[model samples]
Target: MNSESLVKPCSYDPSFKVDIRSHEPLWCCAMTSSDVLVEMSALLSQLESICRKENEPSSQVSQQTGGKRKRHYSNTFQNHGMVLIERMTNLLQKTMSPVPTLLEYLESNSCAILFPRAVLYVKNPTAKHTPIKRAPMDGYFSQATALNQLISLCHQLQHDVTTMTNHKYIAHQIALLYQSINQLGNPKVLLDHRTSIETTFKKIKAELEKEGEKAPCLNSELIFWLQNLTSSLVQSVKTLSAELTSQMRPAMKYILQSTT
Candidate 1:
């Protein structure tokens, strides 16, 4: 899908929690989960196995506090996660032939679903600053969503890397990706970017630093998710800007070097 036809879901606003389930919103077309089944069942099964193994066996209890305090499986689940990941790799290779590269889409291929009939205006011919239109937007957004599903694949991949291989390299790559998301997709970017999404983003980062000082412990994975997405998204503004500028370049310079 190209630019104009990208789906921009109403959820992107992040206003009061929206309940769009009754019917698909104006921007998004109708979709049933089974319609786009790309064969992820095998990988899901591997993940479930990992979860089961991570749980404390009924017999293997440790004596603590007074008796064995049931230790909830948190990060421990993935600590022993490798063999399953290899299986996931096999699933990816075997299934999903000629899959669309992007996971986010509107109808069939969108990640950020747009509101139906919502118009996003643009000023350029080659492209516009406007958001996705109905048709193409759905494709891109769907592709984006599909890409996101692969995160489970990646989690498995990382788990696999944990075994036999030194995890430092893989861990660092994962860390960087997560970090990029934070640096780019800051919440401020969503609300009132024209007023400085960059500044708002910096403020959010600063707050995180401060919070880290008080309660150093945080759901690092979720945080990683937030920041990683944030960083990657920062580039989007630049991309959009370039598209607009390039498309309007000739028209913009029409009056320049005029002999009149």
Candidate 2:
């Protein structure tokens, strides 16, 4: 999904009065939980294919040519692996679910692990590539791990919003969070959140437009609304994460066993 499509343009009109309560809900095409599962399965299959290809030995040939082919495949693997990582991240956040253990397993201790470094090198090919050494894995990535990370991030943002006096920064943060909700392709999940986001942001934009040159500051009402919105987001994501974990458990277990 194009990130640009997530947020619609907010047109400001001088005559238009901002009424937060009277705003209609934003509607979009609905997607089911089963559909999300199908998408996840497809991604897992593609990732698995890439992993298998990365591990395949180069065919016998002249030493120089063999090295070239190996490098070519390594580069290909890195590029594809990076794309999958991004897609997976977007999918997880969109579904309000955590990364599956099986997905992480397929990525660990493989060419997938090198994707981050590869990305850095791509940005600056002249920079020396330094290998990062880590201790042996104590545990695999799991749903709980991802959930904790999400909670931590939310808490950080919440703290920033509460303490920050800069209205523009706070507004930008709110817009970013609201835009993230639009990433939820599922109509069932998006409806309420989208409605809340749309009304709140429109009101804010209208207020800012009205203020013109004056410094923008959120009123108590807006602050309260933001708090409620964030609370709802956390609760919804938690519920969805649990549902996804339960639904995908069997499939994940099967994949892990087969890989072993």
- Tell me the alpha-carbon RMSD of every candidate: 26.6, 25.4
Question: Which prediction has the highest TM-score against the true structure?
Answer: 2
What tens digits encode model 2's per-residue C-alpha lDDT throughout 130-233? Answer: 44332111122344444455445456567765787656666566666655554444445436866877777877766555546465667778877777777766
**Local distance difference test values of all predictions, in order:** 0.35, 0.52
TM-score of 1: 0.19
What's the CA error at residue 207 for candidate 1, in Å? 27
Candidate 1 lDDT at 89 equals 37
The TM-scores, one per candidate, come to: 0.19, 0.40
Candidate 2, run of 10 with poorest lDDT: 132-141
Tens-place lDDT digits, model 1, residues 89-180: 33333324553322221223221222221111101112212222232222333333433433443555344343423222333444443443
